[model samples]
Target: MNTRMNSTASEAAHQFIVIEGPIGVGKTSLARRLCASLSAQGVLEEGAQNPFLERFYRNQRAAALPTQLYFLLQRAQQLAALQQQDLFAPLRVADYLLEKDRLFAQVTLDQAEYRLYEQVCAKLDIHPPKPDLVVYLQAPVDVLLERIAKRGVDYEQRIERAYLERLNEAYARFFHEFEAAPLLIVNAASIDPINNHADYEELLAAIRRMKRGRLYYNPLRSRGI
Candidate 1:
């Protein structure tokens, strides 16, 4: 909506852009906004339809496996649709990455369950196209907690701060080692790119500037720090 992110958007029309982060980090809002901004298809995770999700949240230890397995099947079905597309299909914006499912599995599932999950995933071969760019959003635990509370999702109310902290740390480590795509690591502790035009455009400019490798989106840098 705001100047189309770039005028020559067609050059990158085939890009698969993904937004990644822990829960409450604004992945869905940004992904949807960016999809509309770029005139691309919106691909969101339908974890809410998993049926096992609410129960898992209510009693994670008891329902983790079923929840994780349901998600695995759901992802396979979704990605399989993408895989059926032409390789040159127009740009798409997804709130999640294909590989990051394992990240969740690692954090949520234990040794035996994780192994089984991996084995099942290996058989699915849900090899969707990789994103041309990944925007990894990060925020402090307090900010994340505040946003979570504000969203008023009853299931998410059961999430502990400790688990969110651990998930945040896991995300940091994953992105630190990630190299499959150009990474844009945004410190979103102080800005709302989805609701504020300036913040949104700042990230758009950063996307315009990034061509390869990794970059950091630090608001402090803009403050002359």
Candidate 2:
């Protein structure tokens, strides 16, 4: 825990942090761990509990708009609360970024629908606090599918392999050009941040080393185990 990276991350005065990745890449789990370590507030995305989610899984074309709308409204409400209150502690970790909302819209909606969605989003005036650090987790689609299956969410059981593949690609494309904050791109395919203290330590170190711009982390090649 006293590693250079860990020490640096601890010393830094970061008010906002975001852990982002495709589904089942463990963003929420990492955010939880980070919040615990930092003694910070954690804002997690409420996934699948939305009534429209199961229907979207069963019939994407029929349920896409409603599912998207539900998520948008829920996220907006959360952000509104943050705006009106002392939502952040000395440090704060959120599992989702408001901008990432667009990624789903682009992926799940048709051209016309997406255009309409964008129009609505443009009017929301929701300015999320910029993260001091944005950790982008990456893994193969196969790994994502495996993790999702292991999690045993009944509605997610029917998640098509093709959709997962597309989502993976979309995430990759989004993060490739992402520059909203200091970025740490982590290869999570072989790294288990939970139940793997070494992996978690390495990640903490990597975050500290991130000073500006973007950095890449392949846990397969970390030092001094």
Candidate 3:
């Protein structure tokens, strides 16, 4: 255990912060930047490294359950680790939510498999720490496809545009009724939080001002950046 005191000055005031979005929507990028800006530790999901992922991309029907199970177990372990961390720390940013596991499972697994998976998940004592803020990035299917192609990951090359479209819709529907945390919905179609410091600063400001409930941010409609 890394038993360093939770330095008050370095603490993020909000406890846990999470950045979530569909594949290639810049969740990891934003999470990394936020962690760096807040001088906090980051817990990022290891996506491409999953052994079953490549095979799943090739044949989702045959590989969905194993891939989903791998992810569920991995995320559960990560959350368990997070639960043991010092809460007094300034900030901790994570790239994924345990609940979001169901989104993929529903989309990929059949009815019977999904039900079994849910049962296994229920038996696990993995309860994630509640995040004070959740930044949900949204982008058009075209934009997501373009970004995914630009990244040039081999496994990701098999991702069809149609699949991404459905995934985006699923996310929109999921967040539409979500009330678990203070949600900041961002239109990431045009904003480049990595290279554009102005855009990044604007998002940081929005996060700082978040008091409760949900807020939407569209960089294309915001003031001069």
Candidate 4:
């Protein structure tokens, strides 16, 4: 998903916000809710439009290349459009980050395929709009698999637990090295930011208070405070 950053003068701190997590972590739902709260534009991934997604889910190895390519092109186009115009000028809250594409490519692609993918990516010249803040949702692999089951998308039924574990680890590695913007890591296992109001409020407060570097919004750990 691609989002724009057009914030109210009151919220200069969060013009562009990105909510990221592994699959089925409710990050997209949080992004939409944040858009409502901030009166910002909502950018969602058009995953339904990806013809190869279902196939990729069914056969990741067989379909990884096309699936990745489709997503790459789609996200590039969406972000490029964001670059072109801001007439609507809605503040931006998005579910996905462009840089994370390489994470998936690394996990799913073999060496030669990854090489080709990188070459194509360089050609696309993707310079994503820098988000003012990134909200990363984290949950245990078991929790992720359970959520995926609860959602019950047809193609997602084919997803394996091993893949989820691997994806989670990859995300961990990426965010560990991430230094592009202010980072807010949320322990999504214990709190549901999408459905629980108290949790959401706590997260909102954390967002308001964050000034620099990496911060965490773990309510369970803050019980004593």
User: lDDT by residue for model 3 over 1-225, one digit each (tens)?
Assistant: 333445433333477888988999999989999888877789899987689999999998999999999999999888888768655554688998777899999899999999999898889868788898888999998888888899899989899988888888889999999899999999899788887999899888888877689998976555465
Write candidate 2's Cα lDDT for 1-225 as tens digits: 322345444446467889999988999999999999878778888986689999999999889987997898889888887767762234679999897788998889998888888888888878887898999999898998999899899898888988988888988899888888999989898789887998899888788667679888885655456
Model 2, total clashes: 0
The alpha-carbon lDDT assigned to residue 191 of candidate 3 equals 85
lDDT agreement of model 2 with the native? 0.84
Distance from true position, residue 120, model 3, in Å?
1.1
Question: In terms of lDDT, which candidate is stronger, 2 or 4?
Answer: 4
- Model 4 misplaced regions, further than 4 Å: 1-10, 87-89, 221-225
Query: Model 1: per-residue lDDT, tens digit, 26-131?
Result: 9998888888887878889986788988998888888989998887788778888887875557678898887778888888999999999989988887877788
**Residue 55 CA displacement from its true place in model 1, Å:** 1.1
TM-score of each: 0.91, 0.90, 0.91, 0.91
- Candidate lDDT scores, in order, read 0.84, 0.84, 0.86, 0.86
Clashing pairs in 4: 41-91
lDDT for 3 in candidate 2 is 28
Candidate 1: give the clashing pairs. none
Clashing residue pairs in candidate 2 are none
